[model samples]
Target: VRGTMRHLLVLALAAALLPVASVAAEESDVVVLTSQNFEHDTQASTGATTGDWFVKFYAPWCGHCKKLAPVWDELATELKGVVNVAKVDAEAHSSLRKRFRIRGYPTLIFFSQGKMYKYEEKRSLESLVAFAKGGYKDDTEAVDVPAPPDLIATLKGEFFGLLKTVLHYSKHPEAISQESAYFLAAGIVIGSVLASAFYLFLSLASPAPAKRVSQSKKGD
Candidate 1:
């Protein structure tokens, strides 16, 4: 019983601290635009000579969006300071989704020369790189890419995934930081209580020795 309690406590603490790591996992140099900044970031003025803008609209909960996330992050890093590479959460900003005609969860849009261009190409590393660097013509689209089957899930397993989510939410910029802090504090308190209970349970544990007890009755 005490062993089981200890294990549970450890798991609880680990779960609580998971989100802290997920925030870093979710972060990248790629600019994540919210509803407030989507227009300012993507909308270019007439004759505006700013760098080309490559924006990928995604839904946070979309599996396709999840697969595209790392690739988009890489594209942003490679084209950093050369072209503007960013992402918008369509689910979070429904107005932008409707305005841009984002029918799908992972739509790619590029703005350049004071015009908006929809990218309908493959989302592979090479394809995205080429599209961003002006290798593709105005109308080029490819089949969508999907994650591999029989693949080892990211974060090694669900336990780690849960942990990452916890950490990510705890430090999420959009959500109140205090909420996460309080959550972590509560987790710690619960874990400590469980640990104490486990310790006391163990300290008070007294197993009767089968052979010794039987032999001791005769001695008595």
Candidate 2:
């Protein structure tokens, strides 16, 4: 009989703790965003899609960010099904940091209906949760989220592209080999000469506009 009572008490205790475990699981639902997938995921939230996002642009070592970590977790749990809570490590992802022009450590941005609303209020759990859950409508300051960067163009610019390479080598001559600098200069000169030759050829090839003449009739 004692063993049976013990089993019943253990089951009751486990039932009581199940909610705490569930809450812990919910808290971990905050999405971790990096530069690669940032635009794709955020762009999906625009224009009638249900996954509106509340994103925290934070540095991992920032003191204020560290302080708000738990509250941010709680906010995610509170607004789980209503709004998607996500975070980015700006210190690690320099591209996103530059893209958003994030100057501060912990910047909160809520994206909904193709607009971005910066959160400037106090970073309490209530404030964060409220802002995520349609409280952003009260604020008058909102801006359209910047368009997604073209992957191919971005890759080209980051690596070796014609114009970007020319500009870079022109501005910072010490960055490349001497042969590369000479080639860049030659490319610029050749491009200019070709453009001028094309203009001259077009001018000489096309006929001039015809002139209209009017004369009085002698019969008048």
Candidate 3:
């Protein structure tokens, strides 16, 4: 009789706490998921399920992640029931981290229909919603994503990317064209000048390396 009473008491306690749990869920829009609950929450949203999920992979110590926290709160409030917003702490959950291949902190991914879409747009609420609409597609499809507003930055990035590729393949330094050689020399000169300036400043600020009289050798 006592064992049965104890079981009933446990059930009653769970029932009493249900309302509190529901109210808490109602209060917050974002779901804090760990490695434990990730598969269940995300997988259910696809097969036989009906919700779209937007999840953030973050590390707490990352400054970008810290700045993104409040934005996430706003995203949660705005997305609310329309889309399920969630976060996974990449540092704490190694499995999810590796599974998603999150190379940088504050990586955002949207999951729908057994496919995951990466969000590469600017980290803004509006941008995120736009991505939800059509910024991404399945892995096999070619997504012709437009460049961000800053065209100069985009072109510069492409230029540097091409430069790295060429440099990596060019076995001999002479493989570089004459024009490129001039530019490379200029870059090296500026870098060396800055490094030398820093080194001189540090040398001046540091304590004297050795007493001049040390040459006397303790007595003389």
Candidate 4:
């Protein structure tokens, strides 16, 4: 009886750990993308080709996004070697969020051959896998992916990202670390210069103001 009980305990422990191991395996197949490396990762011109990317832009706290997490993991597993599956935390990566114009809790985009095909169908495992495999081919309305940000746009985006961080630090002084303070000060100066240069360019391009003509009663 003692040996039987020990065997049962081991079985129960194995059962408990199985799901965790499965979830980890599923997650391992999906790439975690961020604002810093997404450009190089997604752009065809940057590095060796790694197939197409099927990216999900999601917010952590969103109920819809949470509901789809398991299905997304399954989708990643299904497309493991066929397509590059990835996810972006849009709430945390403002630059990517702005670049993609992601306004919803969950947005799905498939990048193929430097073009983007939006997934507007159901988010089920089958639908996702099918779309990742070949739905972009049938879709006639593939949108051309926007070119990567230029130097000025990159600087502006970084400055805005830094400004948000500084504002957060202002509300919570305890979170302000030494490195954060140094970056915040430098970012402010650079951001000011970029802002001034942008406004100067706009001012130069704008039409000159019309001059008001004055009549002195015909020199009477």
Candidate 5:
């Protein structure tokens, strides 16, 4: 009876640890690709008999990348059967980084049938899974390239809207003076002028011949 009780106690202890071991094994199943394994794994993914391919380019030192780690892990687990989720450390993979022109950490790239798309914003696990499964539609339209009138018109519309709101709010029982309206108009004008000046400054600063030459040679 003593030996049997000891055996039962050992079995109970093993059973208690079984779940912990299972969780560890599940985590270990997430494929972590480094610079050394990137090419081989990506190639295998391309030739694989099943699933879409998704890769995240990240650097160990980036705070945002660190924050996104658990989200990526959850995405990996949730979409395990539907997608091949992998990660590449950008700092460790100079060639891959250059090839992809990865300007930032935590950039998620999706590939299907040899075509690729870059996810340029933060994404939730559900969204990521839906994207992998081709169930989500990106509703965001491409940004309209700013025309000179577009900015001026937008500023004008915003000023009018603000003026309307201010007038409406001022009609309350504790209404303030109309001077507040003038102040708001002045502020809007000042802000629009400043924004236009800043935009012009950036435009002028961007096309410098020397800067272009420097950038061209930096990669070499």
Candidate 6:
């Protein structure tokens, strides 16, 4: 009776540990990569030459990234044969971040055929699987504007429109007033110069990752 009880206890313990062992085995296949290893892995795989798509951007401190980690891991496991999932820490790899122009944390950048698309918005195992099966289509709406015939023609038309307006005011100087016309032209020139400078300043003011992280910390 004592031997039987011991045998039963051992079996129960093994049964409990079996699932944990299976889970560990599944996790073992999932790869976690740093920024330093990203480029080398990408080059070696050549963007998963065997019908595998690559997801290559993440940030460790991001809540969204942490939330998505398990989903991403499941995706890797589910699509092991179909696609290869990889990650890079955006904060750790300044060079990679600059090279890719990563703008946000938890950004999922998909790579295939030497091209990359930023996977913006919510990420889940299902969504990623769908993206892998079909190509990732950005959620942004594209507005198509027809190009003018030529740069010279477009500039000429703009110049003529301005000239015509000026001529109208000049012809009716008594009605519109010369002072008003001079002031209007001056205001237009000044506005254009100021607008240009403002845009230039904004472009230069774009924040770096480290700066953004520090700013976020201060805000918190």
Q: Clash totals for all models, in order?
A: 8, 0, 0, 0, 0, 0
Residues 6-57, model 4: lDDT tens digits:
4433433332222111111222577877665787887733442767999999
Highest TM-score: give the candidate number: 4
Order the numbered candidates by lDDT, best leading. Answer: 4, 2, 1, 3, 5, 6
* lDDT, residue 193, model 6: 39
**For this target, which candidate reaches the highest lDDT against the unseen true structure?**
4
Summed over model 1, clashes come to: 8
What range of 10 consecutive residues in model 3 has the weakest lDDT sum?
Answer: 16-25
C-alpha TM-scores of all predictions? 0.51, 0.55, 0.49, 0.59, 0.47, 0.46
- Which portions of model 6 miss their true places by more than 4 Å? 1-28, 44-51, 137-220
lDDT of 2 at 57: 91
lDDT of 6 by residue, 9-104 (tens): 343233222211111122333555533345445543244344445565665446677677778778888878766787765543344555566787
**136-181 in candidate 2: lDDT tens per residue?**
9895487877765555333322222223334444455454433233
CA lDDT of every candidate: 0.58, 0.62, 0.56, 0.66, 0.53, 0.49
Q: What TM value does model 2 have?
A: 0.55
Candidate 1 residue lDDT tens string, 1-220: 6566566546656655443322223457787664445555655433435567788887555678878878888999899988888887565344456556689878887777656667776789888888878764546543222212121221122223233334445455354234234433443444345445545655576474476444456657
What is the TM-score ranking, best to worst? 4, 2, 1, 3, 5, 6
Across 1-220, the per-residue lDDT of candidate 3 in tens digits comes to: 3344344334333322221111112245678775446666767333617567888987644678878877888888887777888887565444466566789988988877666677777898887776766566633243222212232332233233323323332444433333234333333333233333434444565676585663556655
TM-score winner between 3 and 4, please give it.
4
Ten residues in sequence with the least summed lDDT for candidate 4: 17-26
- Model 2 residue runs over 4 Å out of place are 1-27, 44-50, 152-220
For model 5 the local lDDT of residue 119 reads: 70
Model 3, C-alpha of 40: deviation from truth (Å) = 0.9
lDDT winner, 4 or 5: 4
The candidate, 1 or 6, that scores higher on TM-score is 1
Q: Compared with the true structure, what per-residue lDDT tens digits does model 5 show for residues 1-220?
A: 3344344334323322221111112343357664335545655334534446678887645678767777888888887776788876565444456556689888877765545666765478877777777742364332221212233343333333333333343344133223323333343344344334534544565655554443456657
RMSD of 2: 25.4
